[model samples]
Target: MFESIKNLFKKEEVFPCIIFDGKIMKYLDLTQKQIDKLQEENKDWTITKKEEC
Candidate 1:
């Protein structure tokens, strides 16, 4: 019971990404698999991992 309660408060790790398709979109939290699929589908769009500063 306590373990489940603790787990509820825990935040999942996020891999932030940005996609440039003639516009600026920031703080896009996505998994590597999703990013790969997006890149594969959108060849013209530029996608990059966001660096934590």
Candidate 2:
């Protein structure tokens, strides 16, 4: 199960970081549109980060 979950995450675009609720979350390299959708879904949780190339 852990291997499957790791493989799933490996397939996704690597996110440098994410800032949510005044906290810094690393290792979540999601796209802007994806983050936007997440924010839309959960209005209370805000996410932002300095996009990396």
Candidate 3:
């Protein structure tokens, strides 16, 4: 019960990613503008969001 209570105050990490050949490549805590730039840079790749870390 104490462990669960402690976890409630802890923050979860999130990441954006581009999947290439069914593999996850995570970019943690990147700004929206940065993600846009990366999208422009990698036009051939598909940008997607990971659930959470």
Candidate 4:
């Protein structure tokens, strides 16, 4: 039952996000401009990297 429900939303890939100061504020679906802005704001830490298997 649970397996069937999980399979319904299965995806080939997942985009990771960043959690800081008790907030989730990063995503891979951002546009290039948004990414640049984020990079400028959070220069101290690197962005999450995607994994391929």
Please give, for residues 1-53, the per-residue lDDT of candidate 1 as tens digits. 99999999987666788788867665688877788898999898888887743
State each candidate's clash count. Answer: 0, 3, 0, 0
User: Which tens-of-lDDT digit does each residue in 1-53 have in candidate 2?
Assistant: 89988887675454555656545454476776777788888787756565532
Q: Would you estimate the TM-scores of all the predictions?
A: 0.60, 0.45, 0.40, 0.36
TM-score leaderboard ranking? 1, 2, 3, 4
TM-score of 3: 0.40
Query: Which stretches of candidate 4 lie above 4 Å from their native place?
Result: 1-27, 48-53
Candidate 1: C-alpha lDDT: 0.80
Over the full model, what C-alpha lDDT does candidate 3 score relative to the true structure?
Answer: 0.62
On the 0 to 100 scale, the lDDT of residue 16 in model 1 is: 81
Residue range with the least summed lDDT across 10 consecutive positions in model 2: 18-27
lDDT of each: 0.80, 0.65, 0.62, 0.54
Please give the RMSD to the true structure for each candidate, in Å: 4.5, 6.9, 9.3, 10.2
What clash pairs does model 1 have?
none
Model 2 error, position 50 (Å) = 3.1
Worst 10 residues of 1 by lDDT: 18-27
Higher-ranked by TM-score: 1 or 3: 1
**What would the C-alpha RMSD of candidate 3 be, to one decimal place?**
9.3
lDDT (C-alpha) at residue 6 in model 3:
100
